[model samples]
Target chain A: MILIRVHKECKRFISKCLKHNINLITIKSDKDDLIVKIHDNDLEEIVRLNYYSQIEIIKYYGIKGVLLNLRKYFFDYIMLLIFLIALYFISNIIIKIDINHENTALKERVNGLLIEKGIEVFTYRKDITDLNEISNAIVEENKDFLDWMSINRVGMKYVVSFEERIINDISEESGNCHIVAKKDGVITKIVADHGVTLVEKGDYVREGDIIISGEITLNEEVKDTTCASGEVLGETWYKVNITVPFAYQDKKYSDKSRYNFYLNGNYFYKKNYDHYDEEVIFKLDIFGNNFKIVKQKEYELSDLQYTKEEARKIALEESSKRLLEKIGQNSTVLEQKVLKETVNNSTIEMEIFIVVEENIGTTRMFEVGEEIDTE
Target chain B: MLDIIKSYISNEKFYIIIMDSAIYIKNYSKIINIADDEIIIEISGTLYKIKGSSFSLTKSINRELEIKGYVESVDKL
Candidate 1:
């Protein structure tokens, strides 16, 4: 606004301004002319009203008279708006999930269950009541595998605690049954409680051969038939073939790394090195925009050559591990020997034989349509 | 009959209210004249003149304005 003094014919000028749809605000009659306050918007055309004039602007008003002052800080305000939006969404994101279980398969099962319940990392955090509802539903769905489960949120992490179901064993009574050899092995020990012991320690037995007969005999004659029960520990053999490369590539990380930012799906940097690893450090969502910070570390590839002796050692370890996976974990490894070895230009292959002490007894009934060759 | 006139005129009615020290006028056509003691405006094809003392516009837009002063009388001219 500007306060102006119109020298002559002020009413005619005001009427002319109103005729042209321009408003004259705050008018006051002076001794000779009229002093008026007019906005800067109508100043241009009102200046051309008359040349014989005494219209002069005396006073200027506030900073809002020029609208360009607000337009200069437009980018700054937009940046501030984006920052506030990011803070809002980032505070509601789930970052980590910790399952308190020592077993790997059980941990994987619980993790899968959590994902099915919509409680996964990088998703929005659920309310406490909703999380409790989901946990109860999961426990109800998997009643056999899980006995109890609870989910609690601490900061950005969801800690899941659970206990597995404990099953009881009910052994059936052995009646008219004989302990036979399940596999071809040499007997290491035997403990018979009933019937008669047909084989002693260090006795080599084949499959389908009964180690404890279901008959009571004296002086090489059958007196009676009774149910036999016993445990037979035997030395079992396993053959494993392993192949390993003579040259192996190893990746060792260096201390040099670069932190780069990403918006939406486009990264902000070019590939500086030919070989490097990228890891996501942090991420945020601002409205519909995605922001991520990634760390890129450059590494050098080096090939380490292995000798025949070193390859043999590695093959032995691998063969033992494979044999253990095939058998149960309770069996003990007795002995291992290299049966054959083949060496190629860049690889080493070995065939190894492993001996283990394990239970080799399987029960067989006497008169239940089974052919019992006790002769 | 009122609906017939409102349909052509867009249903805009001229309304004015007098307060202690301010006068609010809505839907007036244009300003005919303005002075320290009198303000004349056109509303409904008739001139409405407001006699006041030390009249100054407190707020204004395209079709609305608030005049701050001591209002003495309002007459249809």
Candidate 2:
């Protein structure tokens, strides 16, 4: 049917050409554009006489006159060709990767793992497949941390969502154990369940000291043993030693910089310079081919001297940061003070004291025939 | 029924079909008159005159033609 239509259109175009006294033969009609073979002699006459009907020779059998006619739209045709090629390359790549998770740490870990497996942003979609298999493999690899995981593709982006495994403390409930002090602290509160309270409130306890005993005595005789589970809130003190340097190095960048581009793992312009920082200005990756525009700026490091007051402030902040690292989460900072400060050569040294209210008890299991040590 | 049998027997000759606002003609000998509002076609020894508004010979080949427009009348002369 299409061939018949084309043949009919060709005949009609030829007949129209004859009626206009234009010596032309119809080659084909491409939708709206009618491609015709016209004699060189009649071309000028056709152009002058057929002002109402637009005609152009698309191709010539033996003459180069067609190139002159196409010269008007040569640049437009070239741009259209380039645009089509760019579109084809862009459509095959994954433009974005979105991990659906609330925890930033877990998202970063998953993103890193996906990148290792060759499924990342700007990667070709055709290169990654078997999403279910990959998801199962990832879950298996992180079996201790992840319970469920799934990867889905939406347009050019891969959406990853996962569930982390929550480990439950079942040993405390199952074994006969005593709650001992994890660290040396003064007991502020104590709650003992299914055991005897060894330490009362306001009592000072040492590390490894049992705050709650698992033994239950009846008629002043040992009768039963159970898991002693409770919260022993204590006032813990931490002493952190910190040193802050009086002189610190600051980076000073030069105003001069050079620009370069990299395409497909090869640099368009290459230069080697030490102590230079590269800032990426633009980046594009299509079908595994990467393009990057970068600015290289050179810099030097110089020491800047700080005053005594500034050094003390810096030392205090450093000490506080160190103290926080030692203290576990869910602990309340009750009070903090700089116990001692001394100025050394080119450095400020200080000792910090911090008091925190925290859970200072840990469960320890005992064998059936084991004797209890009271030390 | 007689016309159907006759058409089937003379199927190799010229065939003309008049549809809504379109005319399909096959085995046409020549185009007598071509214009924007009317067209005259010859098939064998007879001339078929097609009158319409804004008429156009949209498709034409050897011994075939497709006329498209707001067809007003078709007569055999």
Candidate lDDT scores, in order, read 0.81, 0.75
TM-scores for all candidates?
Answer: 0.49, 0.58
lDDT of 1 by residue, B1-77 (tens): 57434543675587777879988887788887677799999987999999989776654455767787889999999
lDDT of 2 by residue, A1-375 (tens): 111112233445455554554433333446765555555666666556544555644444443544654686799889999999878767866788889999999999988888777677666674335777888898999899899988888888888899999887554556688899998999999987668898899999999999998878778676888888888999999887888889898888877689989888787766756577989887665545788889899888887998999988887667666666667667777887889988988888888887889999998887666887757
Span of 10 residues, lowest total lDDT, candidate 2 chain A: A1-10
For DockQ, the strongest prediction is 1
For model 1, chain A alone compared with the true chain A gives a TM-score of 0.55
* Docking quality category of candidate 1 according to DockQ thresholds: incorrect
Q: What are the clashing pairs of model 2?
A: none
Q: Candidate 1 chain A, which ten residues in sequence have the lowest lDDT sum?
A: A166-175
* Candidate 1 residue-wise lDDT, A154-192, digit = tens: 988899999998764211443577889999999999999
iRMSD computed for candidate 2: 5.8
What's model 2's lDDT at A50?
Answer: 49
Say which docking band candidate 2 falls in. Answer: incorrect
Q: How high is the lDDT of residue B11 in model 1?
A: 55
